[model samples]
Target: MFGESSGRWLDSELWHACAGSMVQMPPLNSKVLYFPQGHAEHAHGGKVDFTTRIPSFIPCWLSGLKYMADSDTDEVFVKLSLTPLTQENTNALLMDLEDGGDDCGNNNGGVVEGGNQEKPASFAKTLTQSDANNGGGFSVPRYCAETIFPRLDYSADPPVQNIVAKDVHGNCWKFRHIYRGTPRRHLLTTGWSNFVSQKKLVAGDSIVFLRAKDGDLCVGIRRAKKVAVGGGEVSVSSVVEAVSCGVNGRPFEVVYYPRGSSPEFCVKASVVRDAMKVRWCSGMRFKMPFETEDSSRISWFMGTISSVQLLDPIHWPNSPWRLLQVVWDEPELLQHVKCKT
Candidate 1:
């Protein structure tokens, strides 16, 4: 039903927001490589001394993966335990694990399962340059307006209405949706620019609009990696703190930011083993399965492997970190891919 399952069009929002949405534990008893150098990158200026004390990577066995989130921002991170496997030497694995994990880590009773879960009508729109410009207006698609939005009274002179939507952080935003213009289309005119300015939204960032079961409008944001502004949302102190906690044999957490720029200092053992079995080389095309929402719908991002090279051949010889240079179908969404000039 994938063909008909999505009411969403080819806009990049649905793909960015819901695709690969599930964040799971890195299963206990699995073998993994912990990269202290990569972890220090996130700690950029924090001068995390763990990088020097630790080798480029440490062979370890996954003891735990407890999912959690920041109380302030509702961002998902994982509390994990990795014990050093002194028997296995470093740089033994030749392929890196996929940097994949996604979840809001709500303290509320985990995720709601079963197909009977309420799924209201939803529409996602990626703001165009015009929509995010200084002009205070966000153009609304006709289908979205007629279906997900509240009905309008055409009899009114200008046919205008005030709409309120809630963000992931539970903040309320009001927009003046109006029907006016030569061809007569729906647009969020009054509060659109204000929302964009406050959220720092740009052309590529997506705004998802939906009708809740309670009949209220809900809005969510999906930011592309480029908008991360100065690396990413992970702070220098936070990265150093997480790695420090890990070294001290206490549970530490890492963020699940699945972008090329954000390297995975923590990864699933099974995913790494499977990837290591592949003899990846130049000119290999593959479809990566990325699930979202209920975890039932599956979407794939097509890509071609361009070359296989060591990220740090000098310091970490034969290390698999970012070893494969590839071109993804949606190159604009990733930062570290090999792009043609």
Candidate 2:
């Protein structure tokens, strides 16, 4: 294992280029809609069988929240504690939805508040074969090197300097930044290989570089999403446990690996309440925003709701899962969506 400093200097908020910035953190102490079936699709890679009954949707309160990063991959995740809303309140919301009323929203609604500041300079690059291989060096994009890295003393025979940066955990990393590759390009040597190995980065995975206003360089990563071989059972089992605990009104924790491209199960209550006012019916067309698979850009997908019925009405009555079947206009892109994952 690589050593990590037990200190912090870099602001975690500035390191959002990878995934955090793409989606807002569900507001704290707000209402959210938790969809177990939607969560299962991402966890098991596709549709899964569930012997135990799972609710279609659980109206929950965001009782607790904490952001975390995987020690190995540096992938950011948010841990959440959710408590189901009272069944009485849920029924009232359903009644309001059926009545097409929009006044059911409560005042406990808003995003988490944070002090604003000048955002830092950040660059993201998808690791190429040469960058992730055993080259002992990483090819840096000219723009990134020139714009984000410190001023290089090109006067020397081979413009090079020692660069010290910190990872998400505030662990310091050093590298030899040089502008002397074959094509007169920038490169990271001396300490690049160790970072690759320790982070277990691959060609498809991405590395994010950030330079705070105080000139502290920070390194973060977004691991490529892969259907883990032999690990589906484990993920599915854990998700099921969380859903069970949540549906029973018991507090449960969910660790959301942001890069997984999973549907935001715990969605802000304000947004959900707004959506609840929609007269959802068959043939209703709608568009929703999604992150590109590369996490490089935001895009929209338009679809039409084919039906509005519970996925399993008998066993999972009033469950919101699969309640709406939509056909996307861009059916081809449906198979692959964002995360570089």
The candidate that achieves the highest lDDT relative to the unseen native structure: 2
Candidate 2 runs further than 4 Å off: 1-16, 42-54, 87-109, 113-120, 153-158, 181-183, 212-215, 227-237, 279-288, 292-296, 301-339
TM-score of each: 0.58, 0.76
Off by over 4 Å in 1: 1-38, 45-124, 133-135, 146-148, 151-160, 200-205, 210-216, 222-241, 256-260, 286-306, 327-341
Give a tens-digit lDDT track for model 1, residues 207-227.
Answer: 677677677677765554433
Q: Which 10-residue span in candidate 2 carries the lowest summed lDDT?
A: 1-10
Q: Give the alpha carbon lDDT tens digit for every residue of 1-341 in model 2.
A: 11122112224464355554566766577667788766776565555667776667777778876665555456565667888888887787667656666544544533253424555677788888889986568988877898788889989989999999878787889999998956798999999999888777788877888877777888887666643432112266677788778777887777565566555667765566566567789888978677654344677889998888877677678765555889889877766654344
Backbone clash total, candidate 1: 0
Which ten contiguous residues of candidate 1 have the minimum total lDDT? 1-10
lDDT of each: 0.57, 0.69
Clashing pairs in 2: 31-269, 56-319, 56-320, 56-321, 225-341, 292-338, 293-338, 293-339, 293-340
Best by TM-score: 2
